[model samples]
Target: MKVSKEQSDANRAALVKAASKLFREKGIDGVGVAEISKEAGLTHGALYAHFPSKSALAAEALALGLELANKKLYGKSADEAPDLDAFLDYYLSTRQRDNLGGHCAMAASASEIGRQDEDVSASFTEGYLEMVRAFENHVAQARPELDSSSRGLALVAALIGGVAMARATQKSNPALSKKVLQGMRELVDEAGGLGKK
Candidate 1:
């Protein structure tokens, strides 16, 4: 029996979504084609039909993860924050840090993308740039007078780095996570204050 177009699309989507989550949680090298197929409840051969190879799937999955992260981090408008304090609090909360299921894909996988082939690296690069754009948008809205891509890039780097560090030390030193997050909060606050001049 031949599958309808809708069915085919849904099957492919399943592989994409499953692979995205696996890529974030397990890294590109950590997950295999068979594992992705199994998670999606499709036969391993079905994966090849949808994605040219695991490398292609890695690219797609990275995009999917970053898209989800964008939605989660920047989904709110400036109206949501009464001040920068609230904004930073919501931005670096443990809820976003610990929940890979709904967090940014770049946070979960960018560090490891360097290990993948060129195709995978390109996907990560594109995704990382997009994430930076999203961050720039938020920073602009938060402080319109002081706009600079360099500042935005630094903020994104600090946010990603802080969150990652917080997670890494959470098991051994829970206080370290909060300290790292608080340090970033102060940095953004100081920058915002300086922008007023």
Candidate 2:
């Protein structure tokens, strides 16, 4: 049967969505195009029609997930914030950490990114810089008097690192996850008061 254009588009989206979940759950190397196609409810050939290679699928899925996360976590950049403290609080919240696909591309896929080939790594790098830009924008707006560039770098580095540490401790000690988040949150408070690291 000939598939409608709408159906074809849906299939392509399904493949990316399914691959996004799988890539988050398992490292990119741990999955194959055949597996992703199966998960998407399409044949492997159909999968190739949308994405020529597994790396292509991974890159697209990673980009999609990051775009979704920026909207979900930070909302519009126009409604900017200088409130690094509030951003830290929300970024490290329980809800944010618990939602794997919904939370962040980097936090969910950083380990996989390191293991990936250069193409995927390049995608990851680009997405990470976009995140940094957004964070820096907020920091600069929130505190024009402060050194916004360094503060932005510190804030983003600390939050993402906290998320990574929390994820690592999830199975071993769930309590530690909260502690790491809380510690990072307090770091903002500490920095707000002192010009210290």
Query: Clashes per prediction?
Result: 0, 1
The TM-scores, one per candidate, come to 0.82, 0.82
Each prediction's Cα lDDT score? Answer: 0.74, 0.75
The pairs that clash in candidate 2 are: 82-142
Instruction: List the pairs of residues colliding in candidate 1.
Output: none
lDDT of 1 at 161: 79
Cα lDDT of model 2 overall? 0.75
Which tens-of-lDDT digit does each residue in 1-197 have in candidate 1? 78899999999999999999887777788888889999999998999988888888888888788766655545556344233344467667877777765566776775887788898888777766765675566567767777756667777677777778877877799888878877877776676442222
TM-score of 1: 0.82
